[model samples]
Target chain A: MRGAILHAPGDVRFETRDDPEIIDNTDAIIRMSATCVCGSDLWDYRGINPVSEPAPIGHEYVGVVEAVGSEVTTIRPGQFVIGSFFASDGTCPHCQAGYQTSCQHREFVGAGGAQAEALRVPLADGTLVATPEIPSDELLPSLLAASDVLGTGWYAAVAAGVQPGSTVAVVGDGAVGLLGVLAAKQLGAERIIAMSRHEPRQRLAREFGASDIVTERGDEGVARIMDLTRGVGADAVLECVGTPESMQQALRSTRPGGGVGIVGVPHGVSIDGEQLFYSHVRVQGGPAPVRRFLPELVELILNGEINPGKVFDLDLPLSEVAEGYAAMDERRAIKTLLRP
Target chain B: MRGAILHAPGDVRFETRDDPEIIDNTDAIIRMSATCVCGSDLWDYRGINPVSEPAPIGHEYVGVVEAVGSEVTTIRPGQFVIGSFFASDGTCPHCQAGYQTSCQHREFVGAGGAQAEALRVPLADGTLVATPEIPSDELLPSLLAASDVLGTGWYAAVAAGVQPGSTVAVVGDGAVGLLGVLAAKQLGAERIIAMSRHEPRQRLAREFGASDIVTERGDEGVARIMDLTRGVGADAVLECVGTPESMQQALRSTRPGGGVGIVGVPHGVSIDGEQLFYSHVRVQGGPAPVRRFLPELVELILNGEINPGKVFDLDLPLSEVAEGYAAMDERRAIKTLLRP
Candidate 1:
């Protein structure tokens, strides 16, 4: 089987590798039907995050289970399924409380390499949620999104405490940010503010139910949000970019008693204690327990209540994974879907 | 009027100042019956927080209203009252959302200085909560505690989402931290874990409903908390310390989905974004909106449901203000009360 591996910075190669096998009694082998490039992946491709050694990459996938370990009872072979980036034993206390990312027994699926012809997923019974059936190619992109980005965006909205009649500010224009707009809309936000200078993304944000768009960045961005919010700031803010500026904006653009949910993979974000303490905003985020929202998101996607798959503007064959990475890194694509 | 004046670091002199009159239309003058030295006062005394010039130095007090401006209708002269360190209109959006400390027109009462014989309070209609009647000396300590420390502690518990059957961990054992334990108990926390090494403070914490006292510092403290919670951490954590280590400990001590409320005046606290992003802990706090809880807290104190005033271990005359500061700085007293 062939899988994507990073030999070094700016290098992604799809080469032959031994097929994965079920290792743990609760593990299963999944043949990938679809995978994609995540925003975090650009970190390594751009040399911002150093790749110490050649390793398997990518963590999002929607596929068919090929084989399952004897101990896997809920999931079986030949079933179509979606898997979260982190494999969780759903029975753990944290998982029971809807924080699967912090599950007592958890594994990063990327370590097993999901961007391959086949992948090994641990904790199969609790990690993989079987779909109604093998989805059509048209439904594949949206289903695959539920594996990470869509569910992540959903988690961000939920974490920020978005509810009916709430006002939300989204601070990023990536796929996750767009999906966050969709999620906020689905969650019944009365006003959704998308902070974006890019015209294309701005259009998509409006289509996703954004009531307002601000082209400012930094202090100007916060000012625009304050202006639009009658100087009270948004009721909730979704921080989909994890830079220092984004974090600060998220904190500052929220009403004193509001909430900020950060889903971006933070690289160098450092928050001043005095600022956070005085801001009076509730801040919460993490790896995003995507599995916790997968079932509901899957149902929503199947019912056509949302079209998060619209984020994937570019599609490429598995052999063109390098171009997919480059396209996203260079802003040529919001998201790139890969067919295996 | 004689007030505590910080002429310079290590130089606190009792000096005379002009008697304050209602300057703002919303202002009121109060005759101080009692005030206290706060932990943060020592910062300027130790030169950590510079005292640029001679400045009045105290923020917490309970007293009798002496005079009021024409605009002050809700409160009148001769009413015994408890006031928060910060004055808020209580009609602002932030105040309406229960975060009065971040009120748009909020005023720090210390600027008018409560350590004097008579003090001027701004936003009188919203800042001063009248007592049922003149509080006895016994109730004075508790009501004065409500002016800041107890109110701050109560905010910490509320922000940490303390509820019935919840297990809470409190970091810091100063007057505020010990009071936090009391607040958690009042909020019905089932098991309260207090991290403190001071024997006297520890005793007060236990008396305030700390079920367990872990006399460990830093990692050891986190380990103790984890060991007690079966390695999952407490359901809620109260961070009463403003240092970086305390912030990290608070983040680490809470369960993945738990909440942390930090009220310490964060001087040099800087939080690592990646650390907080991956931690998945909900963090909320600030200079507590003491007025938001003042009325309810006063009712509880008057009804003898709780006794947070016990945190004040040393009482001194207004002339002994310097000694009061020294006693807390040398760790000789948990809190110091001054009668003017």
Candidate 2:
């Protein structure tokens, strides 16, 4: 089996590796049918995040279970399923409370490597949600998105407390941001503001039910949002970009007593506590517990109520995983889908 | 009229000042019956905060309405009332949303120099909440507590999302922190953890409803909270101290998905975005909208449901205003009340 590995920053290679095997009573091996490069992957590719070892590259996937251990009672061989970015026991106190990312026995699937032909997933019974049957080829991309990006965007919206007739503002234009617009729309938001200067992404945002578009940066962006909201600011803000500037903009774009739901992976950023405290804003964000929303997102995708797969702009064979990384890093592709 | 004046960091003098009169159509002149020294007042006294000009020092008070402007129809002379540290118009969008401290036309009563014989309160119709009748001498201290400390503590508990059977931790043991224990208990918190090192304050905290007292500082404090909760941490943490250490401890003491309601006036604090992001905690704080909870706090005090006034340990005449400030600064009293 061949898998994508990062030799170092800016270098992705696909090489032969031994096929993964069931290592524990709760383990199962999945034959990957589809996978993709996430926005977070660009961090390592761009060398913004150091890659000390030749690490596995992707975390989002939809596949067919090839083998399962005796302890895996809910899933069996040959069944189609979607796995979350974070593998949760799904029955811990935290997971049961809908915080699978903080699950007591949680594991980051891709940290050990997920961009491979056959991937071994632990906690199979609680981590993988099996679909009714094999999904159609056209449904694969959307179902795969339900594993991470779509569910994360949905979590961001839910954390921001978006409700019927809410006015929402999204701070980033990445795939996750686009999905956030879709989620806010699905949650019955009356107005969705997308902040983007990129034309292609703006088109997708509009397609995803954005009510307005603002091409401003920092203070200018906040001004645009305030103007759109009659100076009261948006009822909720989705902070999809984790930079200090983006977070500050998100904080500034929300009205006092409003909420800012953050889903971006925060880098080394510091916020003035005095400003945050006086803002009278409620902030809730962390790693999205994608598993918490996976089942529902899977159902929504299968029903055709949403088309999150529209974020994928490039597709390639697993052998060319390097090109997928390059294209995404170069902004030539919003997302890359790999066929194994 | 004699008022408390801070001429410099270490120089608080009792001096004569012009009697205040209604300056706006919505203003009212109140003859203060009682006022108290706040922990925040020590910020300037200790030279941690600057005292640029001679400023009036007290922000907490309860009194009788001496005069009312033409536009003040809701409140009239002879009515006994309790008001917040800040006077709010109470008609702004923020006020309507229950964050009156961030009200667009809000005015800090302390900055207006309320530690005087008579003070002019702005937005009288919305700022002053009248009691059924004149509170007796026994109820004066409690009603005065409702003016700021008790109200702020109540806001902290409410913001922390305290539930009937939840565990809560308070990270300050000043008058406000001690009152937070009272507030948490009133909200039905099952176990109240008060972080304090002072013997007197700790005893008061337990009396006020602290089920546990941990004198540990910094990381050790976090360890104690985790140990108490079997490693998960408290469901809620109320940050009554504004220092960076207190903020960090508050964040660390709360479990993932819990709340941290901070009312401390953040001075030189800076928060690491990534740290807070990974915590998956909800935070809401600022200049507490004490006015929003003033009505309820007054009712609670009047009904004898709580004794937050017990935080005051010294009583002095209005002419001895300097002594009141000195007593709190010297740690000779938890709080000093001045009768005008």
Candidate 3:
């Protein structure tokens, strides 16, 4: 099998590796059908996040089950499936509460790696959501997104309480944020303000249903949102950037009694309790429970309700995985799809 | 008129003050029937929060309306009324959205000095809720409690998303926290856990419907809560303590996807975003919009559905107001009510 590994900062290598097998009774091996580069991956690639050792690095995948362990009952070989970044036992108290990311028995897929020809998935019955039929090439990208980004964006909208007539503001123009715009639109937000300085991403945001755009950042961004909403601020805000400034902007851009759903991985972020308390802005989100939304999102994609796959602007063969990482790191691609 | 003024730390003196009158068109003059010391007032009284100058300091009050400005129509003279610490126009977007504390036209009642013999309440028509009728001595305390502590506690329960059959935990042993125990019980929470070491307060908590009590503080407190909830934590937690430790315990004590409603006035508290993000605890709350709940709460008190005024364990004459602050400060009284 060929897999991508991060040996150190700014280093990604595609090399031959032993094929994965079902090691645990609840495990299953999947032949990767598609995978993609994520904004989070850039953290390790840019060396901002120290790389301690060489390890498999992708966690999103839409693949076909190649084999299953003796204990697996629900999922079988030859089925196309989308799985969450973290595997969760469906029976845990947290999982039952629709917060699978915090499940008592949860496992991250980073160790197994999605950017590989084949991968082993633990708790296959609980983690994998199987598609009803073989999907067309046109539908594959969207299903692949349902594995992480799209579901995450959907979770952000839900967490922010984007209601039918809500005015939403999205912070960050990454694939996830743009997808959040789409999610807010689908959820019936009357107006969506997307904050993005980049022209290309701004266009993508508009296509995903942004009613307005604020190219400014920091305090200026909050000013723009307040100006747009007649000094009241947006009713719901989606925070897709985890920086301290972005977090503040998101909090400041929301109206009193509104909510800010943060999906970005926080990096050295600290929020003042006094400001948050006085603002009355609710906050709720974590590593999205993608598994919880897979069923509905899969249906939405099958019905052509959303075109989130447009976020993938670059595609490359599995052997050229380094170029895929480089394209995203260099900001040349919004998201890069890898064919295994 | 006479009022209680904090000339300096630990120095509260009852002194003569100019009589309050209906200065604004929307203002109403109220002859004080009762006022009480608050937890937040302790910040200035204990010298933890610096007092810039000598000023009359008290905000919670329930009194008889003595006169009204030309613009005031809904409320009449001789009516018994209760108003929040903050006066609001009630027509602002925030007020309409049930966040009257953040109303566009809002004024702090601290300047009017509820502790004085007379108070001029701005936004009289919006800020004050008139009782159905003059109450007996037994009912005056409960109606007065509805002015601040009870309303604040009810908001905490609502913000925490307390529901039928839900498990709730209150983090403070103060008046607000004890009232929160009562609010949780009234809101149909199946189990209420009160964190308090004080025997009298614990008795009050149990009477207010606390099913369990945890006396430990900080990390040990979190551990005890986790132990009680089968290591999963409660479904809703009311954060009545504003310290970083109390805030973290509130977050840690709530189950994943659960909410923590913080009503305590925060002082020098900062929360790490990364910890909050990964914990999957939802947080929402600010200064309670007591005016929003006035209608139902007024009815509840009139019918004796609750008795939140029991939190006030000491009574003081207007001249002995110094003892009122001392009682709460020295932990000799849970709360002190003052009569003019």
Each candidate: RMSD: 1.3, 1.4, 0.9
Decoy 1 TM-score against native:
0.98
Docking class of 2: medium
Across A162-273, the per-residue lDDT of candidate 1 in tens digits comes to 9999999999999999999999999999999998888889999999999999889889999999999999999999999888888888898999889999998888998888
Tens-digit lDDT string for candidate 3 (B234-317) = 999999978888898899999999999999988888888998899998999899999999889889988989999899999889
Candidates, DockQ: 0.84, 0.78, 0.89
Of the native A-B interface contacts, what share survives in model 3?
A: 0.84
Of 1 and 3, which scores higher on lDDT? 3
Report the lDDT tens digits of candidate 3 across residue range A186-266.
999999999998899999999999999998888788888999999998999999989998999999999999999999999
Tens digits of per-residue lDDT, candidate 2, B273-314, equal 889888888888888788888888888888988888899899
Evaluate residue A300 in candidate 1 and report its C-alpha lDDT on the 0 to 100 scale: 91
TM-score of each: 0.98, 0.98, 0.99
What lDDT would each prediction earn against the true structure? 0.91, 0.89, 0.92
Ranking by lDDT: 3, 1, 2
What lDDT tens digits, residue by residue, belong to model 2 across residues A38-60?
99988888889988887777898
User: Where does model 2 exceed 4 Å of error?
Assistant: none
